[model samples]
Target: MNRKVGLFFGTFNPIHTGHLIIANHMAEFSDLDEVWLVVTPHNPHKKKSSLLDNNHRLEMVYKACENYHKLKPSNIEFGLSQPNYTVNTLAHLQEKFPTNDFCLIMGEDNLKSFHKWKNHEVILENHEIYVYPRISSGEVKSELTDNPKITKINAPIVEISSTFIRNAIKEGKNIRPLLDREVWKFIDLMNFYKK
Candidate 1:
């Protein structure tokens, strides 16, 4: 009712089918109108070396999401400080786009560690959280009972991950179907993740 828009933040070292599916489903099944793929420049939880450059990752996300009208790739973190934090990004986005209501999109796996994020309480207070199921468990209601902004969605789950794709590429395996053909082609042409 508040012009819902989901902000799905991630490294997107390379955007894959699973990521796309969740975004599409969230928009369709939930109150969200669209989902933005906020491609992070750096994630505090992961090693910086393993991440492809932000531009490359952004390009892959662009190609992967080219066919989807509702899915957008944003380099919002490129202008922010390193080791981007969710709350800070949300605050900045809200200030810049005052009219749009943002919902945080995440998987059940990440929700387990969500409490540890920087100013995570501030995030729950400002945004709605939409989570998808994971292979490890069933749906988990928001752990923080006092926080009413959280909502878990019962959407279709796709177990694929970027880690597996990285491993496949490192092992010299085909990944054309695992990701968008354009994305796979771009990665192949650029020889990304070959090292």
Candidate 2:
């Protein structure tokens, strides 16, 4: 069997401590050989405004993951067309890296709405999903909870969010503890998220 790779998809408007903590936990504690932080160029459900440029967000990710051996930064979805779906990205990744077993890393909240995703069943059939705990309101379906392909990791629940980080920065709050040192430096240098 090939090495297992966990794909962590996010806008990563700015990679913060919470994102790193969960990613590092999965890498160090789980069977995944490495975790790729896939920087999304665009998310359909989210508003376009208030988001940093694609490259800016990606740069922060790169800086954040620079020292992480098992964690990587990926701009894979950047090349794909806009409003791309998870299934399509998975298919593309599998095609490009046939040897690496790519599993998805998601939050507990996403699992609740997994059925609504386009071709959700196909994704489940083809790849494993690793879910981390999150503060959400819904209950997960029994069929999904019973699925052998889905694993709920006992990872730390990161209460912090990128939005909080961005807002804090804009308000001239020191959010150093919530972000990687390099990422903070990059954001500060670029004057990002500051209105």
Candidate 3:
């Protein structure tokens, strides 16, 4: 029998509570054996200047996921080419771990721009996509809404964003509530995001 694993891809700049909540929820309710947090070294859609070092980000994810037996922190994208594309990552993972059934875990907001991604159709055809709710302009719906491969989960809407946390930290504001306790401690100890 194939082990079902959900790929929760992100920069995880500092791995916050919101990310943990979503991954944990997906693992428990989505019939997934485990949720792997794939940390992207550089996302094609995001600015590189705003991101922390890949190793640092990976460490933060490790700290946040330490207690979660089902959540695994992955640095698989680190060896991949620059401007990491989701399709390529998924493809590589499938090749490397043939026995594992990989599923894509993302937020509803990503569905809005899903088509623009490289080889999105291939991704949809090969893997199941689990999308969680996000605070957006309107009720999040996608062209893939009718597709059985795409599963929309009513996960909690976490309004907190990595960008917001970074800004708050730079300004010396309290962002403890927005982060995992260990992650917050790591950030504070390393003086991350300080201007």
Candidate 2, 114-134: lDDT as tens digits: 999999999999999999999
List the pairs of residues colliding in candidate 2.
none
* Best by the TM-score measure: 2
Model 2 root-mean-square deviation: 1.4
Candidate 2 regions with alpha-carbon error over 4 angstroms = 43-47
- Model 2 quality (TM-score): 0.96
Top lDDT prediction, candidate number:
2
Looking at model 3, the pairs that clash are none
Model 1 quality (TM-score): 0.89
TM-score for every candidate vs. truth? 0.89, 0.96, 0.93
Residues forming the 10-long window of minimal summed lDDT in candidate 1: 138-147
What is the TM-score ranking, best to worst? 2, 3, 1
Q: In model 1, which regions exceed 4 Å deviation?
A: 43-47, 137-147
Residue range 91-173, candidate 1, lDDT tens digits: 99999889899888888787878887898878887788887888775434446533567677898879888988998998999
Report how far off residue 165 is in candidate 2 (Å). 0.9
Better of 1 and 2 by TM-score: 2
lDDT of each: 0.83, 0.92, 0.88
